[model samples]
Target chain A: MKRAVFKNNWVAALMVAPQLLIIFVFFYWPTSQAMYWAFTLEQPWGGGNTWVGFDNFAAILFDDLYWYSVQVSVVYAIGATVLSVGMALILAVFVDRQLRGFKAYKIGMIWPYAIAAPAVGLAFRFIFNPGAGIMLYLNDAFPGAWDPNGNGTHAMIMVIVAGAWKQIAYNFIFFLAGLQSIPRSLLEAGAMDGARVLRRMRDIQLPLLAPTFFFVLVINITDSFTDSFGIVDTMTGGGPARATNLMVYKIFNDGFQGLDYSGAAAQSIILMFLVVALTVVQFRYIERKVHYT
Target chain B: MIERTPILNIVTHLILLSGLILMIFPMYLVLVAASLDLKDVSAIPPKMFPGDQLWVNMGVAWEKAKFGEKFLNTFIVAFGVVVGKIVLACITAFGIVFFDHRLRMPIFWAVFITLMLPLEVRIVPTYAVAANALQPFQVFMDVTGLTWAINAVTGIEVALEWNLLNSYTGLIMPLVATATGTFLYRQFFLTIPDELVEAAKMDGAGPVRFLREILVPLSVTNIAALATIMFVYSWNQYLWPLLVITDQSYGMVAVELGRLVPKITSTGGEVAKWNIAMAGTLIVMVPPILVVIFMQRWFVRGLINTDK
Candidate 1:
């Protein structure tokens, strides 16, 4: 790892200063303030903040609502990761075999990736609109069958669908790449041994694609936390009786809207810790698998 | 290519086409809704065909929802972020790759830590900082003893209380702390091969000259790639602008699209304008969609390389 060193130190300092400054002022300072507020009792109304260590943590952990949010977030993460990644793997497998018009699918698939989360949520909202949507077509045979707006389970499912729908493109890209990188001779050997397509997938392909699977899983999970804010904010607004209030939504609802600064900051810290741990693992795996195969 | 499985190929086509339908269905619905007026959109099963009101609904969304201003604001914020973050990232990557500075590792890790502490995590404190950007400036002034000197010499004391809230700077500034661009640029720069650097140095090219003459031209594709991704990322931003921009006049199209969602009014007083909401959604998606479509190669390459 030989790096060329610039002779002038001033030039070097000047070069990195802008980005470092942005991060310091925006990223690090706010993070430090969040860390400070996490332990202390910083109420919304009162100006003076009393230092009450661990009380915030205890309160948030003990609260039934917070636990419920945790359960909700976990379910969302797992559901979204599975749906998006599973579907992507399936599509990648089909496309990897060089189906006709696979290039068109490859290009068409990425449109969803570029679509904003809010747009995704909005689009799904109309699709799942209770009265006038295609869902109404289902209710025609059976009166009052489905309504994501009023039903908790339905709302949660819609959020998951919207979240996963946006992510399928991303997961598909990596899976397609990973599947392509597997030596074709291995598949030929599997086929020559009389292994069917499904058998070949399970025995030969899936094992080799583990790294990409793991990578996408972690990414989709972490993305579910931070990225779902848009989908939640738009689709349900964490709503129909707080049905879709994932942990990240709780932070925004409690802190920004509810003005519970201390509690929200505590929630933020908790989410941050989880993501930080995930990101460390993410960085390690990615650095090792630079080509992401 | 490996084995002939006739039934499997047909089944594969069926599944892929089905997946593609799911992907396209929503956009198709949105487009259908956007084209139709209220009555057609509210009709059972909604309108399947494009209506005559596509332009009309867009105009309504633009005029009634003040979408023009929102579009301008979104453009400013997204464009600024792309320009600001990409340039900063390139220089930061250049500094890290080309210099053995003492602070390089610390700076690199600090930027890397931004990856974990995403903007959503510390929204409250970050909002406060955006609302009161002067605190740090004043502290710097005090630490440098400039405040006292200015006060002593000018007989006037100034306390800077400039809030970046609702401004383009407010929108663009905080968001630029992303490490993805830096990481992408750094990875690209690292692949430049030490031989190129050594040869350039032997030819008596200074650091700036070498970077401009060789590295800059070489990294144009990387820069464009990163810019495409960053632009789309910035344009799609929903929460940050929601927090930072409290002023209604500075509304972003993403947030406005959410608002444009006509509420299903209780007591059935007036049906929600599903048409306008769909139109706004279409408008909000168009720029990013166009960008990603036009720069598909670069966009995909940047995303895979950045991997975050």
Candidate 2:
């Protein structure tokens, strides 16, 4: 028995080696270096590195720009998360009903999620371009309606709308899949008990979808912080006095533009901690409310 | 039986039609803009219909964007990344499952932990390592007199002088190890029945033979799904390529097209050629869009089923 167990164990280790090596080289090594660099000030053009302890972190904590970026990121993450998950839930419920052309609705609704972010950003850029954009034309049609390009506040709104539009399709797909997994018999039973469609959704569907909703919340929040950098980078470039500079975008600028390796690393570490803490809090406080069945 | 009421049917169709319009409108506008002459691009309300400048715009875009070379570069980069990911992911997953030992759990944990570390966190250090490693490798090859042969096959020679920034290897190397692919394969392999392995063993089959003959054949669906996902991901990848590939000389179609419109339009209030940019954007988006439209049913089904 001991020999058999040993033989089985050997096979598993051999199988995992290549993956382990790749991960070490690509993921683990780089990650550790980033952590190390967070404590040291280094020049971009290959020079002597001076250990700065937590000075980078201290500077970032006190910096007005950094705090503003953090605030923008948090707001964007929370807003995008709520809007995306809410829209997805609504769409999922709407589509779950017995209706003609259900398949078309499902596919069409999720198609935007399939479009690349750059492409989506470009499309939205064109749509919201000052004089030539359709949205701008629409704004013109409505007198005194906010002009997106005229001010920083409206520009940020446009960014959020574009971001939320791109995210809604992704969230909808996940929620639709989750909705499909709910037993049809339970829905039928609710109908039999004289529950209307909205009542059924409120009483049964939302509770059962807690797990999927929770997952979407985590994914959207993380992605809003990480992935929205591209959209913001391309669209606004964190413009109008850095009003749109979210945390990840700030990290990108710090690392790539400012060449402040220590500052970027410190920002990354902070972002990671925040994400982990948020995920943990969700799991601890809200996860218990999820009805798995 | 649930009754399909007329009002509900109308409402559902309205909702779906509106969404479809919204999804496709931007693409439609791009096509229209691409066809129109530059003057029409910034016209009030934008051009709603196609114009005669489609060919002219394509010509301009091709010339301005260096379309041919960039297309080839993008293809090579995307292809290399795809091939490397498939090969590495399969081998690693196989190793993790078959090579059982005291080190197995630790190795597994290490790979799994990468899922939590976002790629942005590690970019600076990874760039440093890539920059440093390329220098010595180049010198060693030049001294050993194997530079030509290495260059011919691997394309690493061009990569030595930071020319690789816009080259195939630069775009592909960073994307070689995908945590999601490994996780998927690990789960897929775990489902393979022990009885099948035992039967193969009884016939004196080794691990490699059993994997090749039995496991590979049964994993077609999983492989197809993974390939589709990876292909879409590689096609959509923007940041890494943008970071490494510095020259316009070696840009991908997406990046090149992105640069061309801004560069051309920003010159002297010539009114940025919305049409050309739209056309280029549409062209860049076509391949991935087609893949999604065609394989969406399988893709969605695969995503849901593979999670377990």
Candidate 3:
């Protein structure tokens, strides 16, 4: 809605055509097809599908394994979010103090952001190796102290740590930015009132950082649900009695490996709702905070 | 720095140092493993120091995994996505902002709706569409009776099909079909002063000329920023390439590295080659990490802006 604009329909259509075609074919078409497949049961062969109504949903809802995947996905989303966001907040607060060597620490911290999740998983896999890793020393004090491969809970902890490690850099950047955006006079006023560093942070700085904190929490949770596939696949493979079978990984496994199209599509629909709900909350509340800040 | 307490400053440095160690230690382990031989790497207590076999292990992993081709494929796909996304997004944003067309709002909403529908959600059907890039056209032809008409005229059956699986186009195209670039460009376009457009018109610059001569030159920084983000995102793609590219020639390094990790189920008989696995992990991480480091300023801005 600029004041000066071109009034050519054909040129505008030509320019927009490629993007429209791409989204329609790649984004919209597949989305609609997923909705279709969710309600229909496809034959094992290339035969046509039967309209199964709510059968797929019913089956998935009735299955205890599906419920377990949902449970673990929530656990991971919260666990990774709490760990990463908490660490990032602490690091950001220290860096915000403008200590000597803050710049180097900032750069060093965000290095993990550049590393991919699966690579993070692999690196941690090496580090948490019970045989020869740093854990080996601990195992000497108490033999059989660390074993991620055999123990399901240990595997969950390993993946959570790896996932959180990769996320710290991202959350740190945001938390640092949020801290920097706060008015210096407010902190100075707190200092003038004889408030110490932690006092100022707890009272003035953290309240102002609430918006960024919430935004990062929503993003981290969504990411843990969908983006943890790489970590889970590389490190645990949802192993030791399906301890880490996150919903996203389960959808892929069921659709591709298990060849249960309707069931996987149903799961996709459910995950889509979860994402859409989170996105709605983001736009509804977070955007307002952006404007306010 | 307001009245710093000596004890608190020391504590701050200590905490920051520990944070740095926690962040860097895993990567340090990878470097250590990559330098050691298989026996030393899998020893009772891990060797903590670097050895002279760094290059040797890298070469071994590179050869074993055919990383030469994998790296090339990753480069091609990454560059392809960058170029494709930038071009399409630039033109679309140009059309939406510069032109007063009737369909502009609808088109914007169309792109906006895609913000919610990530490829991970509709992965199965996206795989189907990618497996046959021309399926929609074939369906259209069949539905509209164009197939029958063409067949009757040409005395042949017509079923248009083009499989994109295992090709560079398949790997690049789907990732390019996103709203991130378009939204970035649109926001940048809105910031351009209206006087520029008025001046261009005064000088008899049409839409295309204005875009080429005026808008594009001004967008260099934005493009550079988006390019850094897009390159890393494309290079780090795993699931799409894992599904689409079955051929070793098109294997992405991330997926290939994942495959190199010995499954926990296979632990008893096979001694995990932590040395080679760590070597491949380092090799795979190099390009994206280099891009982020070199373009640190733009990369950070791009990350924050893209979320906005």
Candidate 4:
């Protein structure tokens, strides 16, 4: 709230109504409906429903395919977070050295952030196509080496790489900002003390960047869980033996394709809790980060 | 500037160059593939160099994918979302920050809680809601027995439904309902000095006047930044449009690109023509990438400041 403010109730109400109405119709209504369907057995296409407390959850929890989706989702979240964050940190450190044409590198690195994940997926699909590109040479060297379509592990790696490719730009921006925010005097002191570049980064810069690292970690994890839908949908529609059927993709598949309303609703509830928990952790870290700074 | 070791300098440039290459490699492949003809594109080890078929492939992709209409729909949705989000967020933040009403906190929290619940989490139910935009009103009437009373008096049962599916309203409203822009505006508004508001009050400027003459001008950069982000975000939307829009004519570019890649072929085989798909991807990518490169300053500021 501002210290100096207006006191017009009607104007205020009118001003806030549009946003409140929009959120109610879109956010709250749908969220409440999801909770309703999660606890009730409902048919798709506006059919009748019956209340079945916790039965939907029970069925989903017992289903092996649901467990597989959860397993792959965790693997994807972890894999993407690690790959993107690590690559971004490396690139950010190198760029922060103020090498020649650093500005161009920064600009080049950040443009991928603008590219849609689905587009990235499509591009990488071409690059990794077994019949073409680098994969062809590798397959030529060894008769049957790389086929994401036939192999599940290879599919997972492909999606993770594609997912991480876009995120590297995002994490690079933050990591670069974090690196720059560290007082240059600290690095200069380390340099005067004859500490090598890598040693100085490990000792001083990395420690100070813990907050940024944690922030990017939480963001990347949640994003991989939810946002990987695009990449997975474009690249491997959660195919090749249910390998990349991440939770979000599965929800869409089961709800829209399979028409298992209550089951998908229950799964959605579970994923929602996971996201909410991660977000809470993130917000809590942000609060602590404020004081740390 | 910290250390001028020749070995470290060479290594730093080498490492940065490699990172840049890794970043640009996929895009380079897309470029090369988009520029090649079908035969050249599908060759073993693929054509790593650009060919003269760029315009030809783009023309083919454009015609096959119906990108002209798709691009138009995408522009409407993207532009609508940006304008709608900015307007709603601007007014909402203005109300929350400049007023002393009791509903202020409630409304603020209402928007705040939505930050945690992204569209992906409750996608199915959202589709349900969007399919019938007037269901809430119907439910309200039924729960209050208004429908029953009306039926008993007039002998006519009432049911209301406004199908938002396959419409522009359905696409833009849900995407614009997030609180990111509101929070961004609020963060910015708080940084504004109290003295300015006092001066405006002394000048007899009303809340609307103060907002128009004072805050909007000051927040131009912030608005531009948020618009850049929101435009890219909405333009890149895939799942929502895929679910809400059943008609091919209403498809968005991202979803269309996704659709084009899987089963698109002149001969209708399992393998899609990589060249045309790459061309389509490049065409779809041009707008957002250009926005990012041209508005680099605002885009970065929006990303960093919104997170903070």
Candidate 4 — which pairs collide?
A: none
| Residue-level lDDT tens digits of model 1 in A1-293 | 55766678788888888888888789888888888888888655778688999899999999999999999999999999999999998888888878789888887787777888888888888888877657777777687789777888999999999999999999998898888889988898998999988898899888888877878988888989888999988888887777889988899889977888889988889999999889788777767666644
Calculate model 1's interface RMSD in Å. 1.9
Looking at candidate 3, what is the lDDT of residue B248? 85
Badly placed stretches (over 4 Å) of model 1 are: A43-47, A185-199, A287-293, B137-158, B262-270
- Write out the backbone clash pairs for model 3: none
Each model's chain A TM-score: 0.91, 0.89, 0.95, 0.95
lDDT of each: 0.84, 0.70, 0.88, 0.90
Candidate numbers sorted by TM-score from highest down? 4, 3, 1, 2
Those runs of model 3 whose alpha carbons end farther than 4 Å from true positions after fitting are: B148-155, B266-268
- Model 1: per-residue lDDT, tens digit, B1-308? 66678998899889889988978988998999899978777677556889899999988888877988888888888889998977898889998889887788888887877877678878888898898877777877988999999999997786888788989898998889879888998988888878888899999988889878898889888888888888888898899988887788998878887777653222345656888888888888998888888888877878887875
True contacts kept of each: 0.71, 0.42, 0.67, 0.80
Candidate 1 at B280: error in angstroms? 1.5
Best lDDT among the predictions, by candidate number: 4
- Cα lDDT tens digits, model 2, B1-308, are 35445776677667667666765676677777778886777776756888898888877777767777877776776677666766667767776665556665676667766666566556676666555535445655777877978787888654464434545666666676547667777787787777777787888887777768887787776666666666666776767777877876667766554564452113365556666777777767777667766778766755654332
Q: After superposition, how far is residue B165 of candidate 3 from its true place, in Å?
A: 0.6
Candidate number of the best TM-score: 4
Order candidates by DockQ, high to low: 4, 3, 1, 2
Model 3 share of native interface contacts: 0.67
lDDT of 3 by residue, A141-207 (tens): 6888898878888988998999999999999989988899899998999999999998998999998
* Candidate 2 residue lDDT tens string, A245-282: 88878888888898788898888888878766755655
Error of 3 at B277 (Å): 0.8
